[model samples]
Target: MKLRVENFGPISYADVEIKPLTVLIGKNNAGKSMLAQLIFTLMTLTEGYIPRRFLTSMLQHIRTTEDFIAPYLRQVDDLRKKIKEAREITHLSCVKMVVDMIIEYLTQYLNKTLGDFLERYFAMELKSLVNLYSDYTRVECAYSKYSIAEFTITKDGNLSAKFDIKMMDELIDNILKDEETNKLINRVIRSRGGRDFTSTIAAIEKIAEFIFPKRPLLSTLYIPAGRAGLLEGYEAVSSALIALASTAPLKGISVPPIPGMAYEFYSLLLQLTGRKGPFEKMSDLFKEVIEGEIVFEELKLPKSKMVYRFKFKDKESSVDLIHAASMVKELSPIYLVLRELVDKGYLLIIEEPESHLHPAAQVKLMEIFAQLVNEGLEILITTHSDILLRKLAHLVMEGLTGGRANANLKPEDVAVYLLKPDEKGYVTREVNILEEMPTFDEVIEQLYEEERNLCYLSLQREMNEASPRNF
Candidate 1:
C-alpha cells in the first residue's frame, strides 16, 4: 500500500509506501507521528458495522463449504465471455458493474470513517490537522494497483473524497466459481423477489460476499507516546470510566473523549485471552533480554477487571506495573502484545521503542523487532534513536551477508522514510537508509570542539593560580 499526501500537519508533501517493516524518522514536531496515525487509519478503515458484520458472517459460511467450487471455477470463464458480449451490446461489464456498486456503496461511509479517526485520535475538529497556510489537506491511497480513495479536508472542514475502479471484476467473478457457494449466492439474489425496504437491504447483505470476498482485514494496534504513563494509570482510569458509566443514564453524563490510540492501548491491556499466541518464542526472547516478565491476571469485578504485574526472572514476588522501573513501564506493553494480542499479519504501530532503555537494551530491542518481522508480524515505528536505526542497518547487513539468515531483516522487507525540513515545510521521502546510516558528524565535531575549548580554559586557570597570580 502507498499513501500520498499534501498539506497535512507539518508535512507539506509526502509519498510514503507501507512495507513490511516501515519506519518513520525525523526530528520532533516534524509530523512523523501524524503520518504514522494516518497509515493506521488506512489499515483499520471500515465502511460501517453492518457491512463489516455482513461480510464477515458471509465469509464465515463461505469458508466452511468445500463443494460447488469446481463449477464456480468453470463459471469464471463464462463471466469473461459475458464481459465480452456485454461490452459489445451495452458497452458495460457485469463484473465491473458489480464491483463498482460495491465500491460506491462502501465509499459513501468511508469519509466519515476517515473523519472519525482523525477527530478522535487527535482530539480535534476535522480541520485542525490541515496545514494552517494551505486551503486544502489531501491524501491519496492505493492498495497495490487498485486506487482506493483520494480525500481532501477543506479549510471549512468539509471532506471531499472519491475513488477509482480498476479491473476488479475478477474478484466478483471468482466468488461465483463454487457450487454450494453458488447456490447460496443464487438464493441471495432470487429469494428477495419483493419490493420491500428490508428485503432490499437483506439482499445487499447476502451478496456482499460476491463483491468483497476474502479481503484481508489488517489488524492494527497503535501504541502512542507516553505509553508508560498511560499503562501506569490505566487501572484507575478504567475503573473511573466504569463508575461514571454506571450512573450515566440517571445523571445524563458523558465520558470525555480519550485519544483513540490510547483508548486502543487500554483495550489491549484490559483484554484477557488464554489461547497461546504464535509470537511466544519472540516474546520469550524479549523476556530473556529484559530479564523480566509482565504477568496478567483477571479480577471477578465489574467488567472482569484486569491487573498486570511485573516480576523479575529470579524473583518470587511481582510488583504492579505502575511501580515497576520506568523502562519496564515503557516496554511491558510490547511483551503483552506479542504474548497475547497480535498474530501473523497483525500490524504493531509503535512510536519510539527506545524511550527509556540504555544502549544495550535499545540494541537488543531492535534485534527483537527484526526477529518479529522475520516471523511475519508487521511493524511501523517512528524513532529519533539513531542507535536503533544503526542497529536496524546492522541487522539488514547481517541478513545480506549471512545469505538471508534468521534473526535479521531483509532489505526488501524494510523501508526507511526520512522526514526532512525544507524551506516550505517538512516532506517525507523513502531513502536507502540501510546502505548508509545517518551520522550527525557536524554536530559531534562541534561538541568535541566545545569540550576542547572548555579544557583549555580550565588549564589556563590552573597555571595562573599555581604562578600565584590568583593568590
Candidate 2:
C-alpha cells in the first residue's frame, strides 16, 4: 500500500505513492523527518498506541510531559474556535451535534491533549476511521492543512514560533466534515510530545491495534543513533520497539534469540556481495537444519555499554522473527535483515536508517533496499540523505535491466518521495521523485563541473592552457 499527503506540513498539496519499497530523500530540514514522523504516527495510531513518546526522544527541546501536551492544546484551541463559529444549524443535526459533542467533550479537559485526557475522545477518533470505512467504503479525506509554526530556540531557553495556514487548508471547515480528517488530526495531535495534552492516547493505541491486521515480526533489527551513553540513547528504541512488540508477542520462540551459525553465514554472504546466498550452490548449510543458534546478545550488568548482535545463515534463512539486534548496530541488520524479511512477505518501517553511517554506507544501504524489492519485502524508510537518492536511481535502473528483475516489482514500487516546505512552512511530502530527475544535458554539465572542481583541487589545470572543449 502507498501513502499520500496533501497540504500537510511543509507542503502545499502533493501526491505521492509508495509501492512496496519507498524511499524519502531530501536535504536536511527539508521535511524528510517530518514526513517519516507523520507516517510513523499514523502507523502507530492505526495500530492504536501512543506515539508522541517516540518523537520526543528524537527531537531536541521536545522532551517531557508538557512539551508533548503544548502542541495538542494549540491544535485543540484552533479546532474549538472553528467549531464555535460553525454555520447556523439546529443542535440536533448529526453534523452540528457531533461538532458540539466534540467541543463539550473537549472542554472537560481544557488545556489538555484530548487524546491523553479523555479515553472516550481517543476511542472516538479511532471509531471515526474504522466507522468511516464501515459506513462509507469510498470515503476521501482532506487535511486541515494547518500551518506549522517556524520554531526557534531563544538564547534564554524559550521557543519563538510563527504560523500561516491560509494557503494550507483551502477550507478548514471542509476538513472537519471529511471522515479521514479526524484520523489525520488524531495522528498529529498524538504525535511526539503530544500525549501529555491528551489522556486518551492509550485508548487510541487500543483502536489501532484492533483495526489494522498486524504484519508478523519478520527478521529485523532495531537500532538507535548514539547520542549519549548506550543506556541513555537505547531506551528510546527499546521503548518504541517494545511498544510495537507488545502487539505481536513472541510465543514459541524467546522474545529475542541469537542467530544460529547458519543465520550468521547467511547474513555475511549478503554483506560481502550485496546479494544473498548461493549457499545451495556452494555449501551444505542449505540442506541441514542448523540448530541451537542464539540470535540475541544479552545486556549484561553495567549494561550502559552493552550493544546487541545477531545473524542469519545462507540459503536457509526465511522470514521468521527468530533474530534480534540492538539499537546501536541498526544499519548492519536493517539492510541485510530486511531483504530476507521482504522476500518472505514482511513489512518493515525503519526510522532514520541512515543515521550515524558514512555517505558510502548510506548509498550501499539503498542498493540493499533495491535487492529487497527484487525479493519482495514491503519496505518503507524515512531518511534525509541525498546519496541514498542517487543510489536509488542507480538501482532502479539496474532493476529495469538485470538478473535482479522480478515480475512482481515496479520502479514505482521503489520510489523516492520528497517532503518539502510549503507557504505555511508546515511539512508536506511528495513521491514519484525519479520522474523529477535532472535532464541528460543537466547531468552532463554537473559531471563536467565536478571534474573541473577536481582538477582545481589537484592543481592539475594549467593557467596557460585553455580548458578542454565541451562536447
Candidate 3:
C-alpha cells in the first residue's frame, strides 16, 4: 500500500511507498503516530467490516467524567435554592407545604431539563434529594441579608434577578439542613463518585468519529521481550485462534476445540521425553479435549520419539490446526500472530517492536519481515531504536546480495525515509531511503573509519596539553 498524507499534523505532505517491511525512522514529534492511525483507519475501511456511521456518531459525543460531574453538582445547587426560597420569609404555610412546593418545582425542572427519564437521557446515575425529602428529621431555610443585584416580579409575575454566587451558597446551605435529605444527597454523591461513563463513552465515540467503514475494535497489545521466559506457551495456541478469527478469509473459523487443546497432545508426547518444558504438566483433567490427528513431523520434534507412533494412528487432523508451536515458538503470541498476518499479505502497522527484545532478536525480526515480503505481506512500522534501523539497512544490503534471485527488482527496492522539523513547526524530510538508497555497509564503514581517525587526533591533542613540562 502507498501512503500520501497532506495537512495531517506535522506532516504537511508525505508520499511514501510501503514494502513488505517498511521502517519509518525519525526524531520525536515527527508524525509517526499520525501515520500509524492513518494506516489503521485505512485497514478498517479496506476490510469492509467496519461501519462509517458509528465513527461519526461517536466523535459527536466525546465527554469526560468531569463534564458530567460539574453539571450534576450545579443542578443539585439549583434544586437546593428553590427549596430554600419557598421555606424562608415567603409566608409559605408549613415546612411540609414548602417541601411539597419544592418537590413540584424540582420534578418540573427534572422533567424539563432531564427530559422525562433522567437515567436514560443522562447516561449516568442521578440521585435527587427531593425524592427522599419526606424522611428528613428537620427542614430549615436561611436567607442572606445583603442584596447586591435586584429584579422585580410585577403583578403579572414577570421576574428576573442578577446571578449571585454568595446568595446561591447561602440558599444551598439552608436547604441542606434537612438531615435525612442531606444524608441521602451525600450518599448519592459519594456512591456516584468517580463516574467514568462519560469518559468511556467519549473514548468509544472518538473511535467511531473517523470516516470508518465499520465498528472494528481498536486496541493495543504490549509484548515484554525482556522477559520471554515468563511467556506462557499455551498463549501461542490461543493467539493463533485469535488471528484466524480476525482474518477476513478465516473469519468464521472458531477454535472448534476451545484454546489450550494442544496441552493434552503435548502432555502425551511429554511422557515419552521424561522431562517436560515446565508448562507441559498443566494438561491434566482436559476431558473436553477434541479428538483429532496431529502430524508430529510437521512440529519439527525429534523423529526418534515414541510419539511418532501416535502420529500414524489418526482419523481427523483437528489438533494439528491448533498446534502453533511450529509456526510461533520463541516470539510472543502477539508478535507471532501479527507476523502471520504480515506474512499473509495483511497491512500491519507496528509501534515500537524494539521494546524488551535482544539486539539479535531485533535483527532476526527484520529477517522475518523480509520473509513475509517473500510471502506477499505489506508492513509499515515506526521505530525509535537505532539498532532496528541498522538491522533494516543490513537486510536491504542482503536483499541486494541476492541480486537476480528476485525476478521483479534490484538492491534499491527498499526505501528509507527521515522526517525533520521545519521552521513552521511542521515536519519535512531531507533524505528518503525510498527515493535514494541509503549508504550500504561499505559507505558506512568508510564513514566510521574517518570519524575514528578524527577522534584519535583529538585525544592526542588533549594529552599534549596535559603534560606538566609543556606548561
Candidate 4:
C-alpha cells in the first residue's frame, strides 16, 4: 500500500510505499511515529471480519430480498437479470456494487473508530495533528490504483474520512471469477425461486472477499517507544486490575495517559492463551538476541497469577521480567507478541526496535528482522540506529550476492524512508536501503576526513624532522 500524507502532525509531505520490511529513519520529533500510528489506525479501522459481521446483521435486519438487494440492483441490473434468468452469471459489475456497499458501511464505521483511535494514540491533542500553517491536512492509503482509506483535517479542526470504492476492483473481479465463487454464484442463481437465504449469504460472503482479501489481515499493531518502561508499568497495572477486579477505581486516580498502541499491547499481554499461534517458534530468535527467554508462567502456589519470567542461558533460575535487564525488558514484547498472537499476515509496527541494546545486539536484531521478513512476517520500524541501517544494507548486498538467502533481504523487500524536518515541517523521502546510510549532520563523515588529514600532517612532520638538511 502507498501511504500519502500532507500537513499531518509535524509532517509537511510524505508519500511512501510500504514494503515487507519498512524502516523510517529520522531525527527526534520528525513525525515518524505519527505517520506509523496513522497507518496503524487505518488498518485497525478495517480489522476483524468486517464482511461477516455486517452481512450477518444485514441478513437479520432485512425482511425481504428487496430490502437487501434493491440498494445494489441499480448498479448491477444486468448481473441481477442474468442471475434471475438462470444464465451464467459472469458479470464483473457485481464487484463494483459490492465494493461500493462495503465502502458505504466502512465510512460510517470509521467515523467513530478513527476518532477513538486518534484520541487514544494522540492523547487528545487533536489540534496538534493539523499543520498550523496549512489550511488542511490529508492522509491517504491507496491500494492498487485507488485509495481505500483517507482522512482529512481542516484548519478549523473538522475531521472527516472518505473510503473510496474504486479500490482493488480488478483484483476482486479476478476473485469473483474464481471457480469456487463461480460455483457459489451459480448455486445462488439456480435457487432464485424465493430468497434462498443460505445460498445468498454464501454468495455475498464470496463477494465480500473482494473487499477484504485473506492474505494480509486488516489488523495492524504498533510497538511504541520506551516499551521497556511501558511494559514494566503494564505488568504492575495488570496485577492491580486483577487484584481490584475492576478498573473503575483506577479511572478516578490521575495517571499519565498511555498511547493506544501501548494500551493495546498491555491488553494483549493479559490475553495469554494455551493454544499457540503459527509463529510461536519465532520466539527463539528473540531469546538469542536478548541472551535470555521471557516466558509467561502461571504460579498457583500463592495465588493464581500470570507472570513473565526472564531466564538466561547460563542461569539456573529465572526472575520476573520487571527485574530483568533493560534490554530484556525492551525485547520481551517482541517475543511474546510473535509467539502468542500474530501470524504471517499481521503487520507489526515497532517505534524503536533497537532501544536499550548494544551495537552488536542491534546488528543481530536487524538480521532477525530480515529473517522474519524472509519468513513471511511484515515489520515496520522507526530507528535512529546507523548500526541497524548499515546491517540492513549488508543484508541486501548479501541477498544480491546469493549468500545467506535464509536471512537475506532483497532490495525490493526492504524500503527505507528518510523523515526529517525541513524549513516548514518534516518531509519524508524514500531512501535506498542498499546504499550507504544517509546521515543528517554528516558529523561522522567530517570527523573521518579530519582524521585522515591529521594522519597526513603527522607523516609530513616526521619526514621533515628526519631530513636534517631540509630543516
- Lowest lDDT block of 10, candidate 3: 135-144
Q: How many pairs of residues collide in each model?
A: 5, 46, 12, 0
The C-alpha local distance difference test score for the whole of candidate 4 amounts to 0.74
Report the C-alpha lDDT of model 2 over 173-276, residue by residue, as the tens digit.
45454555345444433342233334233322222222223333322222222212333333454555456675545543334432222222233323432334
Error of 1 at 107 (Å): 2.2
Badly placed stretches (over 4 Å) of model 1 are 46-52, 58-92, 166-218, 252-254, 298-306, 439-442, 455-471
Best by lDDT: 4
Task: Give lDDT: candidate 1, residue 24.
Answer: 91
In candidate 1, how many clashes are counted? 5
Q: After superposing candidate 4, which stretches have Cα over 4 Å from the reference?
A: 53-93, 144-147, 167-176, 190-194, 215-219, 242-256, 273-275, 300-302, 449-471
lDDT for position 47 in model 1 = 27
| Per-model TM values vs. the true structure | 0.80, 0.41, 0.36, 0.83
After superposition, the stretches of candidate 2 with alpha carbons farther than 4 Å from their true spots are 1-9, 49-232, 235-328, 332-346, 356-364, 374-376, 405-409, 426-471
Candidate 3 lDDT tens digits, 28-102: 777665555544433332232122223333457655355334433443344345434543422112223323333
lDDT of 4 by residue, 1-471 (tens): 788999988899999888899999888888888888887776666654344544555658855455344433332343345456644334354444445555765576567567667877677556668888788888887743544778887877677887775636566757666988777666655564235555555566666566555444434767788888987788578666565556656667444555667777777667666356788777578878889777668878677966778888888799988899999888877778788777886788998899999999999999999888887888999998888888889999999999977888899988999987888798998888665577633757888999999999999999988997875
In order, what lDDT does every prediction score?
0.71, 0.40, 0.39, 0.74
Model 1's C-alpha root-mean-square deviation from the true structure amounts to 7.0
Ranking by TM-score: 4, 1, 2, 3
**Candidate 1 vs candidate 3, TM-score winner:** 1
lDDT (C-alpha) at residue 247 in model 1: 96
